[model samples]
Target: MLLSVFSCNSEPSIQDQMVDNPGDDGQNENPDEGEELSYKEKAFATYEMIQQLYKKGDLYKENFPEQNGDREYSYLWPYVGMLTAGNVLYELGYDREILDKQFTGLEEYYDNRDYLPTYQAYPVSGGATDHYYDDSAIVAMELINAYELTNESFYLERAKTVTDFIMSGEDSRMGGGLYWFEGQSDNCTNGPNCMKAANTSAYAAYVTSKMYQLTNNEAYLTFAKRVYEWTYTTLRDPSDNLYWNDINIGSEQINTTKWTYNAAMMIMSAVNLYEISDDQEYLDEAVTTARSAHSKFTKVTNGRIFYPPNDSWFNVELLTAYIQLSQYDSKTKDYVEVFKDNMDYAWENARNNEGQFYEDWSGNNEGRFYWLLHQAALVEAFGRIAIYENQ
Candidate 1:
């Protein structure tokens, strides 16, 4: 019983854009000045938030609530929110006890036997007709992360189940991208053209590379390479180095509207492909895309990336891209530092007094849970950077 709270049509209040000071000069303010906070401090803060939301056997109750005689659970947003939080915990060196608890809650919701409407108001609600390809793929990515942290075959097995379902023979038309929902006979006949489709493919590629690293499985490597080729060739805008959000397979027109997350996914996919293959082409693609995105969206003021116009989720994704590229190319140090500066800016300017981020720093609040999920990802990215610096 998932409640469908469809607030997508409403515009965000003007207060959402109310920042205290947009002209603050924090870039030259000394990186070591801010309380000397370690990654552990940030990770623990995020972990405590998770624990407060999910405790005892009452985790499912929070996920599926019955308020005012009506079921009040959003299908996709809550699930993705939990998955993002779980990944942050995993990256912060949390134990399997927490992982098991989170995984159990996700599995229960996904495994519900009752039938419901497929196209509910919720974005990722699952039902007889609903086939949430991207949301399910995100869950798979989280499971894969859990497997990496816990060495648990169960997590890997669950991830494989999700992959198999999406990769089934039903999705042969859209060049391997996942559909948003089921039974669309129009432009989405093959699948939804959302950027999440590309993101899912990229996640699969990354997971496959990791699996190959662990098992030396040539099959996984081959699959990874194939998916990488498809995504880069199809979704990538070679001219602008940015990716479109959707593609109309029927009209053959690329969804020219660019998004920060799509660019981040392209960066991640290119980096993983380069690592697995050690091919200069892949590395060049990654570098080219990163530099292009930086030039287009980021400006350096006081030696820091300043006032980037995009979503907060891209802040973390861009950081991860910078870190990965820096491993192969030391010249990315300057860019990586810029990324850190931008992240600090986000912490100061984007977050509300309640420590929550709006959907878009540019003042678009669709009321989706993706903004919160992005905040969790930022915590994970910072934690990883902290660990790397310490090492």
Candidate 2:
């Protein structure tokens, strides 16, 4: 895995190895400078891309034509993508029509859940052939967001059902942490089983916290705290802000070296926890992690913040972390500036002159769905940053 290969050896502290050139030398350069648009500008560009990609009545395609066989559809990817995108639109002062359509489509899918096949992809082909924890978690978040925006009890009930499905696992490695799929054999050895993915766990925690906020239910809060503890104790790297991608179920050592998205999830979880608890520890951890990630994976080089390893998706994840951390700690100008620089670099380099974006700087096409999803996530991050700045 990329994490294992990249983070094999321990490195210097992020403070000591901080990236030079956060902006022009000595001078405070505006984060939104030439060759890169501001966060709001980039968000508007992404919105235009979404408008161009989907037809008025057509369902969102999970992957582009190059990947996933021309135009394959996914039961959950489009819904999740639209959820993120719709949140961005709402922040941008767009009408509710777009969100309404996205939610209506999602509701139809959940209402007719039987038609969706289980484990349609490889690597995770064994499970219960029904709902998986990861998919259900995403569905739960989308439904909760729907309820938050619409004040609908139906959306709340649906979110609860999805959360309950995810919380129902019993296998040793599977129960404490959410599983990738239901009915996965006890003996199955896969990446998902080997690694307790921070993204899935964090999303589960985030949704649980939100549910608690809406209903004042202690159960949701308790579940969020439990997941947060598991994540912090098992997956986090205390010496540095970076997090391990996964953990060995039995040994409980860091399994996957580290990944950008995992760090992003950790930051988001910390933010959510801080909001609920008013605990400075969570906020401090979020700032530390974001700084560490920014110093190591992303650096300001040649007047731009770029991922040295050249995975553009990391840019998006790091941007999300920076925006989330900045909301609580406005003093983190360096981190926020790096985030804006990286976002600008990504928009400038990733997009073709004609406006299409490659999956990443590496130009791999196998994971277009992952790329698109992260793109939408970055857009949402920008919108959130806008809201924070205004507040």
Candidate 3:
């Protein structure tokens, strides 16, 4: 059993909690005018580097014997990094075989017998039992994207199965929202860290909404609508009107703060709801939240970065949502440039000499390696921006 701590698209970005981007990542102050890499070039380069992290064999680490060195000491969310790249490739229609290989490797994260994804999986042991809901929700979301891109039943079916896993995490315990952990039984605890989190519920709302659109299942639609409603009612901070990170199950108190991914998930869910129902309210909600998230992060350090997650990995969801919102509504256009500027900062400053985004875009590069999700998130962000520009 390989154990490690790393932040991800939806997780705490590993050992560090989502916080300020810190000091100064100089790129914002000195936006590079003569950058060598274009968005497309950065996307391709980062995309390829993330794929290289996938090795076929395992090894051992003396420090962490419990952890699988065989995985090259990598984690699960990085696999989602690969999926993000695959989804981008699929949307751009440039890669089929690579995406397929990504899907197969991603499947390694699933407990085939259980038909659901593990929180973190390795080459031999496969994955975990009690899982984080947000992690599985991301897998489901990517599968649906893959399914749409390829019209593959297997992707859709897997998406639905993972949806089942997400749904199982929901309960009325926290005044109605999905719990952060699922698959707890036989003395198991899925959410030992935090019982319910805003991030999990938000993504839960997103994947369910997308599944509703894909299968035309009213049950999914109802669940999607209900989950979205539940999250808003339960997690929305009444004072500032921005979202908080989670509810403290011990006290049943809302953790009165925000994270970029939380807002991103809500943005995507609301936009999707608008797509299916043509409801102006959903669109409006999405725009409002998008603007709020942008405001929270942009005002931080001179509009330099729109996400302050200690690890910029989670910024992927927020950036994609911002781009999607901009595509869907003109009111969100201004935020698009903010995201572009941030990406520019990342490309100019965060990427190492080897050309992969490390942890945080604060211009202080810590060469720890093993940040596949970190790099791929930026790749997906750039790829989506490129696609948006072409249109």
Candidate 1: residue 206 lDDT (0-100): 65
Candidate 3 yields a Cα-based lDDT of: 0.65
The sequence of per-residue lDDT tens digits that candidate 1 reaches over residues 80-166 is 555656665556666646566666656544643243211222422333224444455556667777777778798787666665554
User: Cα RMSD (Å) per model?
Assistant: 7.1, 8.8, 5.2
Identify the runs in model 2 with alpha carbons over 4 angstroms from their true place.
1-42, 54-57, 68-71, 111-130, 169-175, 185-195, 250-253, 300-302, 308-317, 358-371, 374-378
Q: Which candidate should be chosen as best, given TM-score against the real structure?
A: 3
lDDT of 3 by residue, 14-74 (tens): 1244333223232223223366866766677676655454334321121111222333444
TM-score winner, 1 or 2: 2
Question: What lDDT score goes with residue 387 in model 1?
Answer: 56
On lDDT, the stronger of 1 and 2 is: 2
Q: What is the C-alpha lDDT profile of model 2 across 57-109, one tens digit per residue?
A: 43454433224233333345444666766756665677787677666655434
Q: Which candidate is the best by lDDT?
A: 3
Instruction: Give Cα-based local distance difference scores for all models.
Output: 0.53, 0.56, 0.65
* CA error at residue 223 for candidate 1, angstroms: 3.4
Residue 251 displacement (Å), model 3: 1.8
Error of 3 at 57 (Å): 5.3
| Candidates 1 and 3, the one with greater lDDT | 3
